[model samples]
Target: MRVLLVGAGGREHALAWKIAQSPLCEHLWIVPGNPGTATLGTNVDLAADDAAGIVGLATREQIDLVVVGPEAPLVEGLGEVCEAVDLAMFGPSSEAAQLEGSKAFAKMIMLEAGVPTAAAHTFDDPAAAIAFVEADQQAWVVKADGLAAGKGVIVPDDGNVAATISAIHELAATNAGTRLVLEEKLTGPEVSLLALCDGERAIPLIAAQDHKRIGDNDTGGNTGGMGSYAPAPILPYAEAQALVDVIFTPVLRTMAARQIPYRGVLYAGLMLTPNGVKVIEFNARFGDPETQALLPLLKSDLLELLHKVATSNLADVTIEWHDGAAVCVVLSAAGYPAKPRTGDVITGLDRLPSDVLSFQAGTATNAQGQLVTAGGRVLGITAVAPTLREARDKAYAATELVEFAGKYQRSDIAARGLAE
Candidate 1:
């Protein structure tokens, strides 16, 4: 077992390349990992929110499983400091990561677990959120009730209500003590759906589709993700099991009746609207370039489904996939998401193509070593096929054998599931 995997990006290098191809992950580690998870193992310079140097490096390296690939060290409590040293952590629990560290406490637990979302208002006074975005005449969505990584959500185009009230005073001048959820802009297509919880049964995975702007028909701004794809040929598997029965089983039965039982990787930033799957945020973990386009279409055994959701046994696991597509394609660096321009060097990551993999995410190396460009949605190529236009043509032909000095990507990644 011996896993560790906290974070460094490209969804922790695609969960350290599918947990080093599991056979029960004999050994693997990564904390401040990068350089594509230092080739799938020991990266450990420690600091995925350092909670006492990650429980003293998982009790001095005997770590049987930690796996918290981001969401600012599980919203800063680092899974209650690795379950207070009984350690075998995975993610949730800083009070179930406030369902992704507070979007007005996940719209007040999706309005007390009825679940379908959107139609909000939280504020914390930037002049009462610019007087409710100047008496909203629609097109709102201003977000930033905490975490601003996925560019803190904005959405202000059609008749730009004065740039959504000047982006709610520029995210209230850089989140001076956060608060401001304001929804009402929910229209169509957006689906991430992670799941895999053990807080008391939850499974759904495979339904990706991220493409968070940054140019190419969807237009600019919004980084963290620049491409993605998976079973989302427009959210099907019976509409992803009706978004796991109206959103992950009433938010895992209201976090197991509020004893705060949500364990890990919930995700679900859906929005299939026409009045159907309406949530647009909630990411307790796993969702970068949609976990590198759903872990190469995960055919199961991602370290035995995350050690059965960190030992809760995940109510009889049955997580399998790999039928058709997968596609990743992120690359970016040229001043991405405003001000990104790291070390540079990079180049054709060993000329990819054995079904293209990459991963990295803002790499590093230099000092005469090479492989540069450190952060700003840096690497990620992924491919996997069977269709979806041959995994978006082998992920844009391994994004043209990589490169650097201002790279950038998105030549229509999975072009609307290859034009349906």
Candidate 2:
């Protein structure tokens, strides 16, 4: 089977790596893929959002399946376009993708599905939002209604309603739409659980925990993802299955009832609080650093699994995972999550051990033909081992081998998992 994977990020690189390993995959291609993905397959020059260009390539190449890695294209109706051509694409339709595209829509669905989540209120008027925050007199998470990468939501520090108000103003002024959703801040260790769906059935993947903050010890602002560890100790396989029954099942059933059945990956950002497991957010596609870590531990044929999901036959195949654990540490450029500095020459990748995998995100080839940083979150260094401690240590050791100007990383990645 010939497959065309979309997007240019560490997630796409990991997907390319896993897909290339499948014996069923006859050929592989990535659109606007990074320098790392080039080693795994042919990197096409077309943009991921160019629906017409992607369709033309798929038709011309007679691609067997289309696997999307990012959420932007999925939210832009790429899956619908693929359906128009009878092309098998693994992703949710535009309507179903509202689960990620619009926070207000997700909140509404959660409310209707009886899924446990934070109490929230949507406001279109900034004044009304500020009034609500002031009246509540408690810490609130201010989120932009539309997509803002992974940094859309802002959590005020320690019940500082002033900060919350400022965040509301900031999001209202900067975001394209002034709409906002203010949610009651819930405290707990977060978990990332992804499920593969076929518009009817859902299969849960290994649970992962992502470090969203840019600084160590959960300080500083949020980023796309700093690092992650798979099979989170908090939620084992049996526990994760129970979470699926409580979270993914109702959500999928609700989506199907809406006549926009969800296909592809349904990523639930969960908060394991004292009250219970509550959802933090929903992503239409795979998580970045989480994918970098989780895919390395998957023992099943990724191509077959994705094809089954795209063709609405997910129940035909069973999922399998390695007993070992995996960890990913992201190397970010200077001033990341604000104003990242790029164009710095990178070196020392060839010195890494064969056991470690380096999936590139923000990278490019300069005139000197040297790899350089091109985005905030640069490379994801992943390592798999028999234990989470070993995996975390191995991943951090690999991080020391790579060198680039203004390169930084969280020193305490997977610390919570190790504590568990």
Candidate 3:
């Protein structure tokens, strides 16, 4: 099957690497892919959000399947664009994508579906948000209603409601007209579960734990993702299935009932709170660094699974995974999650182990034809092994091989899982 994969990030590179290995894939193309993806397939010079342009290319090329990798385009109606041409595409429609596009909308869905989540209130006025925070003594979470590239949610270090309000103000400065969602913060370990859906049926992938903070021991600011480890033993397969039964299934049914049947990945960011598994957020597409960590353990043909989901034949599909753990440590530019400095030359990629896969996120070929930094989160060093400890060790070791000026990575990825 000829495929056109969208986006240019570590997730796309991982998807490109995985899809290119499938024998069913006759040809692979990526829209505005990074340097790493360019090595895997034909990279088109088209922006991911250019809906008309993407559709024209897909139709003209007669692409068998268009696999969307980013949430931006998916939220902008890439699935509907494909539908217009009667082309097969793997992603949720724009209406269904509101689950990620708007936190308030997702909260409403959760409330309607009886999905367990934190109680929250949305505010368009900053003063009202601050007043709400001041009135509540409980620890709170302040989130930008719109996309902030994973840096929207702010949890204060002291868990002070006032501090959270301050964070909202800080976040709102650059994100003009920002709407805020303030919720009572829940305490727990978090897990990311990505499920493949075909309007009705859903197949869950192995649970992954993502380190959203930029520093070790979950300190510092939130980034796209600093690192991640898959098959989170904390949320085992049986428990994951229980989550699917109570959470994902109901949510899917609710969406179907609303006339927006979800078609692609349903990423549930869950918190294993004292009560039970409560949803942290919902993403219409695959989680980024989590995808880098989890895809390596996927033993089944990704192409076939994606096709099944897109074609609404997922009920008959059975997915398989390799028995092992996978880890990914993201190397980001200095001052990342803010104003990241780019254009530094990168080196040592050749030194990576055969088992390790270095997926590029923010990198480009400069006029000098040198691979250099082009974004905040640059490289994802991923490794899979028989044990989580081994996988974590290999991933960190691979990070040492890759060198660039001002490159930084979390010192402890999968540390909790390894300690366990």
Query: What lDDT does the true structure give each of the candidates?
Result: 0.82, 0.93, 0.90
Candidate 1's C-alpha lDDT?
Answer: 0.82
lDDT string for model 2 (1-420, tens) is 999999999999999999999999999999989999999899999999999999999999999999999998999999899999999999999999999999999999999999999999999998999998899788799999888899888999878999999999888986644789999899899999999989888889989999999889999988999999998999998888777778888999999998989999999999999999999899999998899999999999999999999989976577999889999999999989899999999999999999999999999999999999999999999999999999999999999999999999999999999898
Poorest 10 consecutive residues by lDDT, candidate 2: 169-178
lDDT tens per residue, model 3, 1-420? 999999999999999999999999999999989999999999999999999998899888889999999998988888888898899999999999989988888999999999999999988888888877777765678888877778888887565766886787886774622777887688988899989999998889999999999889998888899989989989898778767788889999999998999999999999989998899899999899999988899999999999998999987677899999999999999879878999999999989989899999999999999999999999999999999988988888889999999999989899988765
Ordered from best to worst lDDT, the candidate numbers read 2, 3, 1
Cα lDDT of model 2 overall?
0.93
Shift of residue 324 alpha carbon in model 1, Å: 19
Q: Which stretches of candidate 2 lie over 4 Å from their true place?
A: none
Model 1 TM-score, 2 decimals: 0.33
Q: Which candidate is the best by lDDT?
A: 2
Q: Count the backbone clashes (under 3 Å) in each candidate.
A: 2, 0, 0
Which pairs in model 3 have colliding backbones? none
Candidate 3, poorest ten consecutive residues by summed lDDT:
171-180
Model 2 residue 83 CA deviation in Å: 0.6
Backbone-clash count (model 3): 0
